[model samples]
Target: MPGLAGTERKNIAPGLAVSIVLKQDQRTGKLTEGVVKDILTKSPHHPHGIKVRLETGEVGRVKEIHDEE
Candidate 1:
């Protein structure tokens, strides 16, 4: 997570429609959102970060993982 916090880019979430920032895993394309459901760093495609399903029930990868502001 070094050199990531100062990117000036906000994290993303499901249902918020985001552009692919960086695709760590083509199988699980990375996405950046302005809003999200549950944000957490888990063991998945992106060992860095991932966003959970919102009220809409959708899960996706977060190029940048940050709490809701």
Candidate 2:
């Protein structure tokens, strides 16, 4: 718990439950379930998208966000 001192984070504003699709192969349409671990934003010149870290340790980008139920 060395880094736990300042690791406390508050709830994200406008946050809601969301389900992301994890596609292993978009060509074949193969996909799996994913859990959003963190949301990362890119620089202004680095394109535009939200990076999501799945519970399965898979990291990818999503063009848009969706609400689930």
Candidate 3:
């Protein structure tokens, strides 16, 4: 999917690289890239995006899921 959704957890597994918008950067729409550490959103779908914590310990909503290859 282009935009991250809560239901797309399978598409965004741990260790996967992704771009996200941090709580502070929501206004600027800044994208932070990092490896997924944990999935915080339990819902199947979120309007904004699936919230997750990166390996770097940065928490944010997934904006895009990057391919491994």
Please name the candidate that would achieve the greatest lDDT relative to the true structure: 3
Q: Model 1 over residues 1-69: C-alpha lDDT tens digits?
A: 433431222333344433223344546654544444554444334543444444444444445444334
TM-score of each: 0.31, 0.39, 0.86
Candidate 1 residue-wise lDDT at 2: 33
How should the candidates be ordered by lDDT, best one leading?
3, 1, 2
Candidate 2 regions with alpha-carbon error over 4 angstroms? 1-32, 42-48
Tens digits of per-residue lDDT for model 3, 9-51: 6667898889999999999999999999999988767778889
Residue-level lDDT for 11 in candidate 2 = 19
Q: List candidate 3 stretches off by more than 4 Å.
A: 1-7
Per-residue lDDT of candidate 2, residues 1-69 (tens digit): 121111112211124223333445445534344555665433322232244566566655443343353
Each candidate's number of clashing pairs is: 1, 0, 1
Clashes of 2: 0
Q: Distance (Å) between predicted and true CA of 12, model 2?
A: 8.2
In model 3, state the lDDT of residue 47.
Answer: 75
TM-score of 3: 0.86
TM-score of 2: 0.39
